[model samples]
Target: MATKTHRYRRVTPAQLQTISSLAIWIPILFAVFKLKTGDTKFRLFIIFLVFGALVDSFGMIIYYFLSNELFDYHEVFQILYLWYECLFFVWLCFFFLNFQQKIVWRNILLICFSGLFITEFILRIVISSPNDTYSSFIYSFFLVTSSFLSAFALLRIAENTGEILRYSWFWILSGIFIYCFSSFFVDMLSYTAIGRGIWSIRVLANIIQYGFFVVGLLKMNKAQ
Candidate 1:
């Protein structure tokens, strides 16, 4: 009797990169075509989306060129990308909060968060390895908290004023909330083998999140 053989197929980082690029760029293209030129919020959102897509593409190019020969360079690129992502989320959270609150408070909150992020970035650079679990955990925690808080604030504003379902911000916040919530644990355990194994799941979560972003952009465009 012949024995049966079983083989496992693993997903590659390059594949994840491709998936992420598609997830980010498809919505960006949709926003470009569907969104109007007015509405400051939508305009800023589109700008950020485009910038993010460009960054992702650039990272992929770097990875293709340097990953095999200069692994450290690839890692550095990834760390820089992560740092950029953190800052972008901080700005995004501030943008949402500012939309609901006073300008003075917005400025204050932005300053505070900017300081915190800078401090954390420095500490991560000084104290943690490039693949440090704690650094990823801290970044994930900040993103999750910011996303949840912004979502709650948006909900409160909607409750007092009008339908939350009708607002673009609501959908955007919902997407952030879902993405951060789903990835929180994975990020916390990012230094572990199990965490590394589940990266594809995180990519899928991001795809769903970006889908919500597209919907929000469409809704916002319709409203304008």
Candidate 2:
């Protein structure tokens, strides 16, 4: 009897997207890190970006190894990645809120949203699988809400400070707004026909969003 061998197939479009984005991100992140040596305001955002990139890269590696398995860990990785994504956006919102001199409103909203997120997370874990549609919906909703709230807060600050266009956070919030606005609908209809049609659109939105992030980092470098 002859031994059997398996040949790996070409990468999928999603995997290609991850690889391409990382290629763009690595150099930009390095430049940003060098420029933001002592900047504290963007520390958390930078950490999140690097971590997200690593996770995405690891996910692609897992895909290559377990692509043929019936009960592989790829779905688990995806769930964990989605959870991190939601949590990071929440952290970003809190970071933005810290800019406000008065903490009362920020505290109230933070408490409420945090509670809601915890409750939803528990429900998701107890009642659904990691790959549940409802879990994705909930996570996407949280991200979208956090992004919009952050954008609103940044705008309020810009209005009061009178140099909104010059602020790096303005561009960051703009990117978040574009990505989350498009993603909100995608998440809602992720299992539907419309979702399939909008998949390319979502990818385009993400690319644009990350482009804004690069632009924001460049502006910060100039400002410094």
Candidate 3:
């Protein structure tokens, strides 16, 4: 991703992004090392962590090697990965569904999230890339997902309201919520001129998200 124009700069934009990507390893490794295999919820999370890493790795390779080619393999990789991510979140939400009104709430939330994922997958099939209109849909998608996630996280924390820091589920859900909300803004601003600035913020938010994920894993181990 480095270019001649960026040669004069001390730290290129691509370099910064690459550096920030290192943060993703934290949660992945933490889960692998600290989280027990018997923990079903974290086991689901690790699946996504591994899957996302594979998708991004493949996308990066395609971009680096075949960017100038006619085929837009990289973009396809991104869209496919994003679509899977939406579904993953829905599953994640289901995994965290442990409220008092479980039967009613579970059915309702599952219906909503399933509908959203189906609609988004259909849109992805219709729209080829991150077009201007498609970007708006993506933004809205994240907004809705994040809102639901945050509400759930808050509800979970409310049970042991004072011990927020000790709740692994809260931290894990908070990280996902923050990432989704931040992604919503990133998609919102992707069409504008200040895209680079927004990209940096997104990168920073991603790094911090994984940090929160690591903390969550640690809390889970400690609570065990």
Best by the TM-score measure: 3
Per-residue alpha-carbon lDDT of candidate 2 for residues 87-136, written as tens digits (9 for 90 to 100)? 55655555555455545655565565566556555554555434447555
TM-score of 3: 0.73
Ten residues in sequence with the least summed lDDT for candidate 3: 122-131
Pitting candidate 1 against candidate 2, the one with the higher TM-score is: 1
| Candidate 3 pairs with clashing backbones | none
Per-residue lDDT tens digits for candidate 3, residues 130-152, read 34665566656656766576667
Candidate 2 vs candidate 3, TM-score winner: 3
Instruction: Note the clash tally of each candidate.
Output: 0, 0, 0
> Candidate 1 — which pairs collide?
none
Clashes of 3: 0
lDDT of candidate 3 at residue 95, scale 0 to 100:
55
lDDT of 1 by residue, 135-172 (tens): 67566676676667667666665765477777767788
What is the lDDT, from 0 to 100, of the residue 34 in candidate 3?
67
Kindly indicate the candidate among 2 and 3 with the higher lDDT: 3
lDDT of each: 0.67, 0.64, 0.66
In candidate 2, stretches whose alpha carbon ends up further than 4 angstroms from where it belongs are 1-12, 23-28, 35-38, 65-72, 97-131, 221-224
For candidate 2, the lDDT comes to 0.64
